[model samples]
Target: MVDWLTVLASGLLSFIVSIASFEVRLRREQSVEESAEVEDWYTETAAHAAEVRRTWQRLWDSPEHPGSNLTEISSQMGLFERQISRHASSGEQLDVDPDVVDALDALAEECRKPSEHSFHSNSNSEFVEFRNDILDAVERVEEHLAEN
Candidate 1:
């Protein structure tokens, strides 16, 4: 006589084991994908930071800045602000260091201030602070990328 109950129970146990195995594989694949995404984000964020720093340096170095309505400079600032903001927000979601995120915010805010014309001259104390802050933020981001 066939032991139907015993066969059914064995089949059920096998099915459960297969399900668990598939779940483990799926989780591992998800983890790998997440890690790759994080790495890509870091690389992109670092590149953006470097670009912002370069653009800001050009703005500060330009002697004709802040006096005339140079559309090109304004456009560059707008792009830099957008990039910084995007990276800053993404970094927050990725649980990047608070200090780094804060620096990013500060840089974006400073870049936005040209619209207000708050600091008319780069020779002023505020200009120095702003310049230093931008450089510092870029350095921090670059260092982080180097370490990873």
Candidate 2:
């Protein structure tokens, strides 16, 4: 006589093992998907940062006097600040070198200070240097992403 109970129990055990194995595989795939999503976000954010830096550089290059429109300058600064804050809030480090941040902050402070004179040679030099620093940071971030 066939041992029906034993066969049924064995079948059940095999089915349970299969289900467990599938569950583990699903979890691993999900983890991989999540990781890819984060990486995509990082790359996109880096690109946006680079674009902003370029825009700032262009604005600085304009013949218009720097302090002529302090309001516009302030608006741009606010936008940059928001961008950095948003990335930080998203749990992604800005990936900008510390030196770059310091240079930018210094430039911002200098802009905020009242100047008796218009754009001096030193002022242009400082602005160019700060812009270059931001570009460098963007390049570093791009390289890091590429390597990963």
Candidate 3:
């Protein structure tokens, strides 16, 4: 009373199910890896922004003895900005806003060519404003990424 066609169909269905499950698991793992990479990039970028702010603070604190690290940090910031731009424009799952990326890029450019007045002044209000703007932009980017 056993039907050979029924047995063959059952076997085929089981194989299909197994392949689908594997595919779902593989996609999930890839998503997690991509998310982790995005997080790492954001962390590194934020750290660089913080360092740039700290360097400006140090310069303001000791206007007569400015360190030579500003150019180096600024260059690093520019690199990060470019990487972020690439990710944002690559049609990837990165939900970052273009405006936020532009803001960060502007900050990087500002850091690269700091105002002489801001550098020599002990108050450094301009630098403070720039730091706050950069932090805000970074926070916005983080928020967007969190939604993914």
lDDT per model, in order? 0.69, 0.55, 0.56
Writing each residue's lDDT as its tens digit, candidate 1 over 1-148 gives 9999999999999999999999999999988887887777777777777786776666666677642333444566667777788878887877456666676776677666543444355535555565576677677767656665
Q: What digit string (tens of lDDT, one per residue) describes model 2 on residues 1-148?
A: 9899999999999999999999999999988877776666666556656665666655665677542433454456556655654554453333334443443344334333322223554665555554565566556555554554
Q: Which parts of model 3 are misplaced by more than 4 Å?
A: 63-93, 97-99, 114-148
The residue pairs in collision within model 2 are none
lDDT at residue 100 of model 2 (Cα atoms): 37
Locate the minimum summed-lDDT window of 10 residues in model 1. Answer: 66-75
TM-score each candidate: 0.73, 0.58, 0.57
Cα RMSD for candidates in order:
3.6, 6.3, 5.7
Question: Lowest-scoring 10 consecutive residues by lDDT in candidate 2?
Answer: 108-117
Candidate 3, backbone clash total:
0
The number of the candidate with the highest lDDT is: 1
